[model samples]
Target: MALAHILIVEDDAEISGPLERFLRINGLATTAIASAEDAASVLASDEIDLVLLDLMLPGEDGLALCRRLSAANGPRIIMLTALSEPTDRVVGLELGADDYICKPFDLRELLARIRAVLRRPLPAQGRPRQTEAAYRFSGFAFFPQRRFLRSPAGLRVPLTGAEADLLLAFCQHPREVLSRDTLISLTRGEGFAIAVRSVDILVSRLRRKLANDDLAAEIIRTVRSDGYVFQPRVLAE
Candidate 1:
């Protein structure tokens, strides 16, 4: 496999230089930028796989940079901030950072986060692709390559970002009673610290989109305390 290219957007030379060397020695390519302006220049090149962005920069704040990066569809970002506040972390996640690490963090943990973000499967956004080890269940069809989910009557369902992730988890492990905590971990990214009630809200929204007015129990049956299950036979594609 090709080495993952990482970009470090940190103004502090003391921090940026060491992190760059650490990652470089670990079979990864690295680029270090001191400001958001320079980082934006790097992003326009479209070559980076992951970004390690600092929250406090000189000119534009890290939060603003993150928002611009999200808007421009730049590479995946993992925030590196000195702020230890939970609100700062939550805001970073909401702004689309894949993970957040406070300053004075271990290098190993940072590397692990980088690997985890790189390992996540890409979402389907175009024409469908086929996969043999695939399944059809709960009124949805799974094509791994395409990441496509077609309804039972052959209607194409357009899932939002969160909905696609939650549905992917359900289809992957059908019939298993996944608890609210488990579901949240599977669907919500690691940085998400939302209430468990959010899962119910997601389920309700997904159900309305999938069922229209038909509200059938067989489609994502909720177990009293065990959570929910994808109650359909999954055909391997």
Candidate 2:
């Protein structure tokens, strides 16, 4: 298999240097850029599988760059920010980032997120037949290949990488109540004990995006002791 190319877009030499070196040591091809413009140039020239984007750039901000990248076909982005606020993370997710990592992070944690993102089977590369290309569940249509969701009202719902992975995990095993430990291990591609709150956070975000704010049980339902379940009748396409 070809080495996955990664682009590191950060103005801080301290952060970017370590990131580049670590990725290289792990068998990934990496290009580090000091500014958003340089990052864009690298993106235009390379086949980057993933991007590590700093929120505070010299010229164009990370949010603006994220929007621009999302508008076109681009690499999966993992936003790097000093901001640890939930709102900040949610905003990044809404803007199409695959994941977000706060500053003063562990290299191992970042590697876990990278592995999780890469583990997602891209439909363009052809996935297993057991996993459907598209699924219709209740009034929501899920296209795993595109990481998209459509409501009954025909409005499109955006999904972050983590959200998509969680949903896909559940959909792949419908009606089964997955344990929190199993969820963390499976969805994250790491056995590290992540806060169960993170799973709750992703579920909450998906529920809101799916218009299940009232807790109507439109799609996902949380069990008291077990875990969450994809409640809709799923039809494979």
Candidate 3:
């Protein structure tokens, strides 16, 4: 079997150099790049499995790169940020990054996060066949079995695997207020471990995509301090 190919997108040689060596030593194929431009080139020409992206880079910033990746059927992304950058982390998650680790992060913890993300299923990648029908709401069509969303404008709206999971949950229970913890459980199940805050971020990301068209207004609505409600009455087709 081919080893997992990881792309390390950090401008800091001090960090990327050691990270590359460490991941390679742990039986992963590692490629290190300095800029988001070079990282985009590598991603275009390489079959990378995951990306360890840094927010600060020369020229194009990591958040912009992450947004581009979110729109593409691309590899998973995990951001690397400073310890004081909580806002960046939330923004990264809103941009569809799979995970992130604070700078000065423990190598072991980062490695563990990498392993966890690698093990998680990607959207529409070899999933088992399902009898569930496609969902139609607000002129948008979501085929859960295929793991893709089609807009009313007949364009394919890009969605991360995590976003797909969360959308599935909302479709399954439309008009119901789904709390953060309930959403985490519904999307990931009991064994799936993720922070409740992640659920909120993912909802924000999904809402952004769902509201891509001005005609499709208020598909999802926040329920004050409770959770959130999927407003449109979804119908299974």
Model 1 C-alpha lDDT per residue in residues 34-125, reported as the tens digit of each score: 99999877877747878899999999989998887765545678899999887677677656576778899999988877776676665433
Residue 135 in candidate 3, Cα distance off native in Å: 4.8
Point out where model 2 deviates above 4 Å.
71-73, 85-87, 123-132, 153-155, 212-217
**For model 3, where is the 10-residue window of minimal lDDT?**
121-130
Candidate 3 lDDT (Cα, 0 to 1):
0.81
Per-residue lDDT value at 104 in model 1: 92
Candidate ordering by TM-score (highest first): 2, 3, 1
Clashes of each: 1, 0, 0
Q: lDDT tens string, model 2, 1-237? A: 138888899999999899899988988888998888898778777778888999989889999998787656366888999999988887886676878899989998898788777776543433345655777776778888767788777888766666777777877778888877777777766665456776787788887777645345667788988888878777778
lDDT of 3 by residue, 116-150 (tens): 77765555544566565789988899986446899
Better of 1 and 3 by TM-score: 3
Q: lDDT of all the models against the reference?
A: 0.73, 0.79, 0.81
lDDT of 1 at 187: 60
Which 10 consecutive residues of model 2 have the lowest summed lDDT? 122-131
TM-score of 3: 0.72
